[model samples]
Target chain A: MNDFKIIDDVMPDVPPPVVGAVAEARARVFRPHRPHRLRLRFPVWAGGVVAAAATVAVIGTAVAVPLLGDGAGDRTGDGATATATALVDSPGAEEVLDAVADRLARREEPERANWRVETELIERWPFAGDEFLVENRDREVHWAGPDGPAVVEVSRVGTEPLTAADRAAWEQAGSPRLCGSDSDCENDQVPYGRTRYIPADPGDYHLSSVRLSPQELRELPQDPVELKEEILSRWARALKDIENSDTPPGGDVPSDGDAVWWVGQRLLTEAPTTPQTRAAVLRMLSTLPDVRITDGVRDIEGRAGLALTRDTGGPYAERIVVDRATGDPLAVEGMPTVPVPQLKGLPTGSAAFSKLIRRMGWTDEAPALPEGCTPRTKKDCLR
Target chain B: MITAPDEVSSITAPERFGVVFDTHYEEIRRYIGRRLDLDIAEDLAAETFLIAFRRRDRFDPARGSVRPWLYGIATNLVGRHRRAELRRYRALAKTGPPPDDDGHDQRVVDRVAAGVTVGRLSGALARLPRGERDAVLLAAYGGLTYDEIAEALGVAYGTVASRLSRARARLRDWLGVEL
Candidate 1:
């Protein structure tokens, strides 16, 4: 007996689809994207610039680089950096964004030499088996000053199931101890609970693809149009350099709007950008297509803010929620629009990842490294 | 000459994706419908195309053709409903194939023998490991070649061969017939 034919003979034959179902399904392909809040792990530096590779090496941890800048331009088949002509569908969002940019531009604060940012990052860690969705939450502190080598400290808080369904699946799989043995853990997984220090340079900061010193970042053009041009040129040069390299870029080429948004995020979050420059960055982002604003959203920490979302047209949507009053960014998150098969049981709309900004500003206090890590030794600390 | 944005890039143009949808939608729907019911098939089939359109740029032509790639995505979507698939197998094992009312007496007797074989096959399928079962179903229900199954499952060709070998061996033992 032909086993394959036998298997085929047993299966049911479904009738053709209802006449309109196919048309309706095809219509879904071109329907406007509905922006929803999903909390994906913040790629932070990795998604934006090549310099963030330094940050990855410092922590001895490899972060997943999200599909950056693969948005309307990629879909529309316009070449990269086509921001000027991108359609702005949400005028209300533009108004809110403009108001925030104006407020940020007028605000003046004292300049300081040292900066510190404390963040709590929750990432859906990958696993070999599809039994459970494991979320590894960590607390990261980066402190840098003009006079000293920058210090990066990471302390893993915990790792557990991401959702209720994941917990059930874990328990069903005999609850194999996660991150317990050599076989149970991902190779690149940062050791949990203990704070590990990594060496960093104060000058290794990037505005998208362009590396800028603290002084240069502060002195950057404040006009939104000028800033957009500068960023686009820098991204074009970066793309050219990547093309010259032996290895291919490997993923979707980011559009100019994607580049602008990536730089805007970098400026708001980690870069010591002047308030006026930050304002210009926000204004630059408002001009891009598919950038929508949602009022009255809360971050993972329950702080309220207005959310600015860009549907990257990849698996996840990039989101940055900012304080309505001061325009300071409260959180950066990546939310999954499609179900990732590896993350077995994450619910449809639950946050698969998030980074809540606990603290960020100029500081007088020095970075407290882990026991054996010195400020200048340039050594390994995870023992 | 100014190139229209819609036709500039054939690989990622939204307008071009429609061609792919029209070509493969019914075939993909039937594949999913055979594994699960037609109701879930319609929804999942639509979703599969939407996902395919979103990720069209990531499709590497060297790995395989669009047919297996679409099948890969559809198979992945079906894998999401693993419980439903396993339940379907167990239920099929218990009930066997539904009797056709239009058959004659001799045909009915032949169908009864076929029913026993089908039930045994279903039972054997339900017991196979998930990877092996996926390989088997992609071969049987999907009508995909060993190469296509390998690409669809993102596994090596040898792995597909081994999975099919192990799964068919178990089926042969259960049915006591040449596979």
Candidate 2:
């Protein structure tokens, strides 16, 4: 049997009329699609007027004096509605963020021995029909110094069958022992009590991984525009490397706006930044024209702070809450704003998650295991 | 494979999308058609072009040609209909050829012979793993070279070779012929 020829002959020729139909469909549906750049380039001055009118209407207060520009024309009623719908078009929000940025620039980085960051990550997986198994992991990460290797320790702090039905289903599935000596059991069957420590290597640092070396941090431009450009070039080069390498494609290529947002996230959370770099990052964030700062204090982990947010036009919207007094980032939250079609059965916006910055800044004390953690290996207890 | 010259210049040009659609539409349609029914293939092929047109700015021609990239998108669409594909192959294996419309004595004989070969081939294909099957079919029917297949599947070049080798070996064993 000719395998190649048989597979080749599986389909008959596509009828010629289908081609005409597709062409007509493309012309009718797709031909008129315009790039977002055209819409984004509308005059900022016009945006400012509309923003002021909308603010006055929504807040039920007299319009505050325009910060940067004067109200241009009599375009007020429908124009206000349009500006209100477009959440990121607020120039007042930009002004608030710029003030926050100026505050960050004057701030100083406190001296410490190591950088310690604590995070709580919760994950839910669907189990037997209409049930979910949830796991919460608590992680503590320490970098010995700005340029030093990182030591990461993660412990699964809690696990519960998501619902009563889920609990019953778990019992039916043999109430599988967790964190046992047996390697044969399913991962979820094992109890969530183990702590694993990963020792870092010097070469593991990279901009793509969001961990910057001290040298790299020091070299960053203090000027906001130059810093943004440097971040763009660095991130673009990193993406190109991934494309050329055999590694699987990473996430979608970040747009300029996305890159700016990511740099802010990195500085606040992962990047080992000097005080100057951190201040510059905040200043750069303030200058981003599209960023929208929410008015009123936001409470993250019971700590009240100002919120800076940007909608990525994807499944999740990101917001960073900063200490109102210190201008230091207190928490970064990603709440799902839309349903992710790829992950089936989850309700829309149901799987909201956040990464709270429990601790940050240098400490004179060395990294150590948490109390009550029984070391499974010698490396896990290494100082 | 010859890499296309950097098409970053044409990315934002909406008119260039028609050029891409017209050039590769037929081949992409047939590629999906072999793995699925004609009607679904037609719809999917059109959807593929729409997605490509929308994401034109993200396409970097420096990586590979537009052809493999289009095939990659088509392949992902096919992946979603995997059960239907396997069912089609199994059905072909169980049933012999459909009765011929244009009946001639010699043509009838040829159809029967072709049907027998196809039935056995489908049976063998149904037994192959999904990744291996994808590599084999793209190589056989889509006429993609090994490098092109690597780009299409977003895998290492060596991985493509290994998967295709294993798949071909299994096919040979299943067919009881040295091929």
Candidate 3:
């Protein structure tokens, strides 16, 4: 067998205890995929919107936090503490970051010729507790607070220009695979299908030829508000107009694409009470140019969603998650990143599930504490 | 439920959703046997898949399937259960042969490989840093890429590279070769 394919040959059923454990976990934290099911529950949809909105209100605009160096290697120390000591005692104390970053950048890759942007993150904390999709390999992290604009190395996603075929394909899929980072995507179904398009160094990828999804599409009667969401999701017509519109420049905001979103999100949140207001809202939204609402997701509440804008290096959404019943903005959370796909399959973002998803890849349990580690939210440590 | 195994086959294709453990557990068992002791390899291999099933969604579609990630998970479980893995090697080193399933030595190569590996491999593995050891095992044994290793360890891409580089250098030092 090919070395990479060594583990791929075959497998077996897990032991009963393990199977039982996973079953319990699945019930508690995940929802199995219903290949042919698309239940349109309006109230649940509205609840999802509300949940997202709450996330926005809670997470706020700046997602960055001061982590690292807050803990020591003491048995009671958290990631921050251990990282702090690691930084001080690091072999290349002065040049570790530079060396690590350079080594990371220079590593050989499968010469996949496509647009790629790199990110450089500088912090004095080990970001062990979060679910960030770290795009690169170098994590010469220290446990310290940013003395300045903490450096973060990022590779701007080298995206294949929105081709006619890609656009048509996304439309057929019933979800717009618009421009945005993977973080903006839900369930990684990747309506816009990336990573595949990164163009492998050895020409390992090929277009699927087929554009539409095999899954059933939901034709829920979208009321006027839901109509706005549907429009935003129709990338070529709605979102495209926004991306092509004239956007004002600002310190942190992008110059060309986001102004339309700022206005659109405002309108969606205002919950236009009258027909005249709704008309004006739609017209105003229409003016921004093509609005690709590709990063669609069902937030913790369960409403289907769409991304309205992407910042210079972030997600700028003017999402309208209707009460599946009312199809109005039930709840919304304007965000920098979207909920991951697997987590979205759940019925609701229960406290336990939310905590589990955040610690998806790690094994270390949060330390037992006398008065436990006080974290920003339950996602990190106990309240 | 009444018709046939053909009807059952439609519901569970090895390609779509692999077979049950009892029916398809041997290769993984043999894979673990190649490195670890007889005592824990059996159970550790089982725990690996259980954990893999739970975190299956996070598996990258770009990576094609769950096998690699499962191996990564298994590797981690084995790391945590280091003692048992070492015991397998230590027993082989002491006996000058790997223990056979039949309670009798059958394969001649097992005797030579087990005896030769017992001391050297275990000592070298023990000396490796957790990150580097994982990188090496996943690459040399699990056959994962720098990217997959990064995702599995929750470290950055650069960390995977440097860790691999250092790991290779150390393994060479043990093998008495220069990479």
Candidate 4:
């Protein structure tokens, strides 16, 4: 027998394709295939009719916080303080969201072949008694055209003590090495590692591991109820591996509501969602059983917005802070609601993890690729 | 492998591609499944068939048979996910088999031996160049002949022979196993 026969003994045993999966695969070929018409231009807002329709719809009657800003110095802060942030449940979440959705619908969006999102991610991982905060700036450019793949470039910013107390503790511990191979501290947790480009299908963009085609996203249900069902179905398919595997990567499978919230956050922030679909997602989220809205909450950037927060059934409550007037997502925060054994030094109410959305919009300019790398480079080219 | 009359007719009758899919889908899926995660394998398998169906008019039976043609398409799709495949190998090299097996008496002993062989081989496979690794897997996991692999990878027959020879030598050096 050939020595190569040993490979068969090691390969992961795959279960036979299920009936639903087989049918889904079959439909891809049998269905009438038409390439989505590549949209080069955006619709210019025909002011009077669209504005009049939105005015008749309910404007936010709940609160008095101004939403519009000059967009200068708007993006800052990691919100790593040890203060306990309280989220008071309010009935005005739907009203506020509806008004914001109406504004987003009438908002003027630029037309560009590529979209880029620059984010500053700060994560605090507590090991033993000392806590380490790792920061990385990630830039992802999604080419909306059919030919080019999405590119993601990540730079390791730095790792340091999260607080002054933690810094003092670090000094007392002889300022132990936080980086390099010798140190036990692990900072490079973001899966994309250095810089990589993923060859997604035409008109598709990636969010974490899930791929969302722009045409399909734009074609999502406008009605909130129908939209929720659609999201749930797609999410179930994405979560299949986690459900089957005894030891999933991230521990237990998320609850249905948790899964919806997770996907909805990506749709709102990462994926290129239409105004109608964004509105639908917001409305749908407001109705989720565990999700609640906290009005007048300031993000790490010191920008005040409504925090659409959901109880994660853990120490941390996942929250997405969106700009009040424009409804653009400003930041995502994982605020600790209770003290846990793992994180002894961190306070209960402070955000242990936060991703500040510095810039997210369409641009004609493509991201600066690595040396000797172009938009069409299929493999990752290291600099 | 598909020697049936209806299967042979699919080369000419493009409409009969569904018959080809029905016959080869599981086999093509298993070939990719051995290289990558099952979820990704399922997706790439479907994509291979879709591409094949679309390019059926381009099918040149004079060059090769349909089985190798399908493998070619599937291998190309696997190439797109090269990073994920490499990551899988690295993880397996460190962790041995995924803790899927129930620790029974004799089975546990078999698993330990299997895990050791897998770990040693995975480390070597992960180090091989993508071309050599692809050739090795095509012969080992895909159970394709050297000619079939050459056709599948769009390489010369001699190239396949040299790559396999080098890969086998490297595996022997790393694994210290008898070929």
CAPRI accuracy category, model 3: incorrect
Query: Which residue pairs in candidate 4 have backbone atoms (N, alpha carbon, C) closer than 3 angstroms, thus clashing?
Result: A84-A349
Give, for candidate 2 chain A, the lowest lDDT window spanning 10 residues: A49-58
Candidate 2 lDDT over A1-383, as tens digits, reads: 23354355542333444435654433322322223332221111111101111110111221111111111122121211111222434446545555666776776777676776666543333332223343333444545455554556555455455556656766876654322111112111112454444444343343322335666775787766677778777755654553564332212233455455555566666555765677677666644544456645453346766666654333445567677556677766544444432223434443333456677777777755444322222111312
What are the per-residue Cα lDDT tens digits for candidate 4 across A194-303? 54333332434433224466667668887777777776667556445323433212112233454456567777776667777777777666666656777678886578
C-alpha displacement of A123 in model 4, angstroms?
0.4
**lDDT tens per residue, model 3, A281-369:** 33333233333232234543354533222211112233333222222333333332444221222123321111000100111222222
Residue-by-residue lDDT tens digits, candidate 1, A1-383: 23465666545456667787665454333322223222122111123321111110011121122322233323432332324543344446556666887899998867676788787776664332355677766777767687333766766677676677777877886775554211233211144545556655344464445556666676788988888788777767765654454321223354566667777887887666778988887766655666667767777566887777777555566677788777888888766666654444666555555777788778778776556555344233543
lDDT of 2 by residue, B1-179 (tens): 44443332223233224445556777887788767766666656765665454334234343457787788777765664566778878886777334442232244355445343557877888899877877777777778887777767656678888998898788778876544
Query: DockQ of each model against the real complex?
Result: 0.08, 0.08, 0.04, 0.09
Candidate number with the higher TM-score (1 or 2) = 1
User: Looking at every candidate separately, what fraction of the true A–B Cα contacts under 8 Å does it contain?
Assistant: 0.14, 0.07, 0.00, 0.15
Whole-model Cα lDDT per candidate?
0.59, 0.51, 0.31, 0.55
lDDT tens readout by residue for model 3, B4-66: 332222112211112323232454544554556433455445434433332222333333234
TM-score of each: 0.52, 0.45, 0.31, 0.48
User: How many pairs of residues in model 3 come into backbone collision?
Assistant: 60
DockQ of 2: 0.08
Candidate 1 lands at a TM-score of: 0.52
Candidate 2 vs candidate 3, DockQ winner = 2
- Models sorted by lDDT, best on top: 1, 4, 2, 3
| Docking class for candidate 1 | incorrect
- lDDT (tens digit, per residue) of candidate 4 on B1-179: 32344444454333234556666788898889878887677766865765564334333343356787788778766765566788888887887666663332243355346443556667788899877887788777778887777767656678889998998888777766644
TM-score of chain A for candidate 2?
0.59
